[model samples]
Target: MVMKAPVADARNGSVVDRLVGIDLARGLAVFGMYAAHLGPDPGEGGLVGFLMELTHGRPSALFAVLAGFSILLITGRKAPKSGIAGRQAIARVAIRALVLLALGSILGCLGTQVEVILEYYGICFLLVLPLHRLSAYQLGLIAAATALVLPQVRSSLLSVAPNLLDPVFNLMVNGYYPAVTWVPFLIAGMAIARLNLNTLAAHWRLGLAGVALAVLGHGGSLLALSSRALTETSLWWSDVDGAFEPSKSSFIVKSSWIAAPHSETTLSIVGSTGCAMIILAACMLAVDALPRLRKLVWPIIAVGSMSLTAYVLH
Candidate 1:
């Protein structure tokens, strides 16, 4: 959890010159995906399902927020000079997203495990492109709205206009994001960029807020899940194929244990909680020993750093 200290001189080889915590978090996030899906299917009501519900969906959110943070941190420098960095920033993300889209398609077509997050990340990255111009607060508001509307928007689009919804549309809708869409996460990252969230790592209050937000976001989702009772929802649907549906491949596997209606809310709450905690922990894990752990976690951190690469490669 401890990250290497930041070395301001990018010309010099310094872990801080690169985003260490994000890489570590990314590495952890990918592994979480591997574990949650590649392992045994946790039936909707089983113990493993419960664990998956809590952890599986959370890391990506964290990954995505970091994605935005990275984009801003890397590109924010130009915002002050001539908006030149901002332009380059857009181009960088655009090229990366296109590659991801292509990679996602390849993974979906070729891999036995067709759950391609590369597509979602690619799509989300594109969505964030325009939001780059907005202030952090504006971006955050947009993100919040996107989160609230995404599920409903997706459901309606699928139900009413499946034919109109082409493959790319499907990829964006039921394909990748599902209920807890990554768009908001991307925007949250963008908002951070618009504001200087990285600097806040030094602020105790901000760190506490990150903790509080994590607790509240995760806990509230859990409470809501417990109270809402998915059995009552009109949207409850299951694959019932008794096989891992690659089409339905998401961060979480298609298992009966966590597949029940009740688990949806549970997953969101736990996932969000995990996301919040990971971010907070990443920031403060090892102020002293980060230099050493950084070396240890470097591979994982690289995985985190090249999440797009990994996602596409997968």
Candidate 2:
């Protein structure tokens, strides 16, 4: 699982080695998505259900974050500033986006229950193109702003958008994995790539930061949920007839501050982003601490290496 120290190429001095740990993380994400899609629903409450809940929104966020990392690798680990090379890199990304959009459209036509992410992913790629030159700190700021602000913007937009065009509105805001809310994951990944992830200390810091974010997000949500201001009315209560009704409401009230898993709320975004960071940090640590295990998991790494193909085929 450990990455070989980045070997400098004599001709370019650029580090030319793959981080097997990243691939391993991607492999896990792919498997999580599989469990989410193909595995039978472990209906609401039990160890199995709890595990499913943990995996619910986080895997896709992990994939999105990895997409940003891959984008950086493809475009050159360092910023290109502005030149023929930069222009060419951008062109390649645009073409890839188009291909993803086409593939997603084709897949979407099959009417499978699985919500397609490729098209939205393509849009996210385009969205970050102009900001590619930003430093990691700038990107982090943007990510934070996007996570904090975009959900509220989406909520406002949702209320005003025409019901006749609800489908389109949903894709942009209300649907499973809306682009506006998901883009932050990509930005955060790009920021992480700029950091010194090879060191154990860096990984430890990232893990601790992730834990803090998760606690803040989830704790804030819990506090909001329990407040008398929110509980004074029946609005917070379950209104459905079924025993297995989802505990979290799909509807987003203006005053609602509680995070609901997969609800696309601001707290949900922050919490999921934290979960993603923790997973990546854990993967990095595992590889660094147990390099020998990499060979045993080579197949998983191979699957991750060709993740796009694997995702499409699955």
Candidate 3:
């Protein structure tokens, strides 16, 4: 049996009632980003450091994925519009992207240590426009292809176009968060939204799949680390030593493919994407399992509802 919760009508009720869990998740993502930005450096080696390490790339990945979900919601969820309405919706999104890009550029010039993601995010919004019409299955296929193929493509492109100022190179190769590598997360989020998330069975399946993917992705990284060939070819010994050093600039290895937290490698994408799915599934289950806690969770929901504003202020 397909054990399920009541699905919200696509056209009914306030936005909160339809997707409270998503908003809460967004709030959590924002909080995580704050912790990453303002919290003590994880390289200091302590309880706080360990916690920061755990939150590092995972939270940002969740934010990217949630961006995709938000897009679907804004475009009318599973029932996307056509004709005049569709054109108008696209225009609105384009305007939002432009605004975000402007804000990000302004913020970047301030010289804060924080690597502003808004610029990359704005570009992603525009890049994903053509993909908005794809079905969930189609999006999934594209996401998978991106995760598996894009990194290799990036490595090759980097070999040829090493200049960071090149627009294509910047977006795909060496930017803070390359849209090419991150697009999979966005696509996956949209695909997940198309699923029947208002159901125990669906949640269980998604959660389990997430766990499995995390293990697979992380395990692959570990195996790569252990490989004699890889160890000999790269600066693996220094990288391993650097991993343990307690410095603000020390690398936090989250994937076997690359030790850097935001390397945008294939394994990093897979592992981080898995983490995002797990968080999303858990949020959905929590909303169903703990209805009484809604009052307590209201602050998070409120933060999530105004995420764009909150993100800019932070």
Candidate 4:
């Protein structure tokens, strides 16, 4: 049975009527980031290393997807608020974006090994203002198009200019969370919100979609790489020239895709998006299946509820 949550507004203007499952997922992201930051290096080589590696890109990708979900939650779930309410929501998001940007900037100046993502988060939020109005299908198409094309666009521009070192350029296209390609995660999350997530059927479809995309993306990348190795043809969608190694292979070879974390290839985008969707769907399903589990994971939910603070404190 679907649990219907009572909608409540927060006095502080934060969205309070949250999906517990999402909070749980966010909590996991927060904790996963901790693991990513504090855990042993992936190069350690063992089950522990593998587990540590898993924490690397997926948590942050999950965080970005949830960021999109949070955007919808802040504005209006499944639908954008209209007129005055809409304007207020927009303003609120804008303000939050600025706060995150400022906070991220400050944190970045501290010179930690961890790349601050909040500033980029803020940039994406500001970009989402007009975008929040698009239909789920439209947003999905935009996301797909961006994932498939934006990275290539950026790569070509970079190769041509080589010195496009402007702050805005870096923030939008080349940064840790490049808004150019990375915005797809946010858009995908928004599309998820547009769906009828209250239904078991919906949950199943979301999960299935995740599986399908993961297989398509990762499997395709492997196939492409293998093909490149065999054929000695460097068919690439990412910056092939940058990754090309003549000594490694007497014949230059680069594939059209890469599944490596943060590679921003079509495959990485698709696979990471799939992984995020799977996590989100699984969290939602688990919450629905075992309502009692909420009590068990209360600490995680609590951290997720205060994710920003937790992130900053870290």
RMSD of every candidate to native, in Å, equals 6.4, 4.5, 4.9, 4.0
- TM of each candidate vs. truth: 0.71, 0.86, 0.85, 0.89
Instruction: Tell me the TM-score of model 4.
Output: 0.89
lDDT of 4 by residue, 1-314 (tens): 44434445557554445688888889999999999888997767689976877887788889988999888877887779999998898888899999999998999999999988898999988886678888888988988988888778866766676567888888887687787778888888888887778877888889999998887877787677776574422222222233444355433323336666766667888988898889888888888999898889889988988899999999
Least accurate 10 contiguous residues by lDDT in model 4? 232-241
Candidate 1: RMSD to truth:
6.4
Best by TM-score: 4
Candidate 2 residue-wise lDDT, 75-102, digit = tens: 7655543578778878988898889988
Clashing pairs in 1: 2-286, 6-16, 43-256, 43-257, 43-258, 44-256, 44-257, 44-258, 44-259, 45-257
| Candidate 3 lowest-lDDT run of ten | 232-241
User: What is candidate 3's CA lDDT for residue 313?
Assistant: 93
For candidate 4, the per-residue lDDT at 235 reads 25
lDDT of each: 0.55, 0.74, 0.74, 0.79
Instruction: Score candidate 1 by lDDT.
Output: 0.55
Model 3 regions more than 4 Å off:
1-17, 229-256
- Tens-place lDDT per residue, model 1, 1-314, is 22344545555555545546656766777766776557655456577765664445555666666777666665562252136755776787788779877877777788565466677777877777766667767776786677556655654666677566576676666564542456667676666545543443443444565666555554554454345563322112222232223354432232212322213322333335335445644544543334666666667876876676675555
Encode model 3's per-residue lDDT on 220-259: one tens digit a residue: 6666766634432222212322442225233323233652
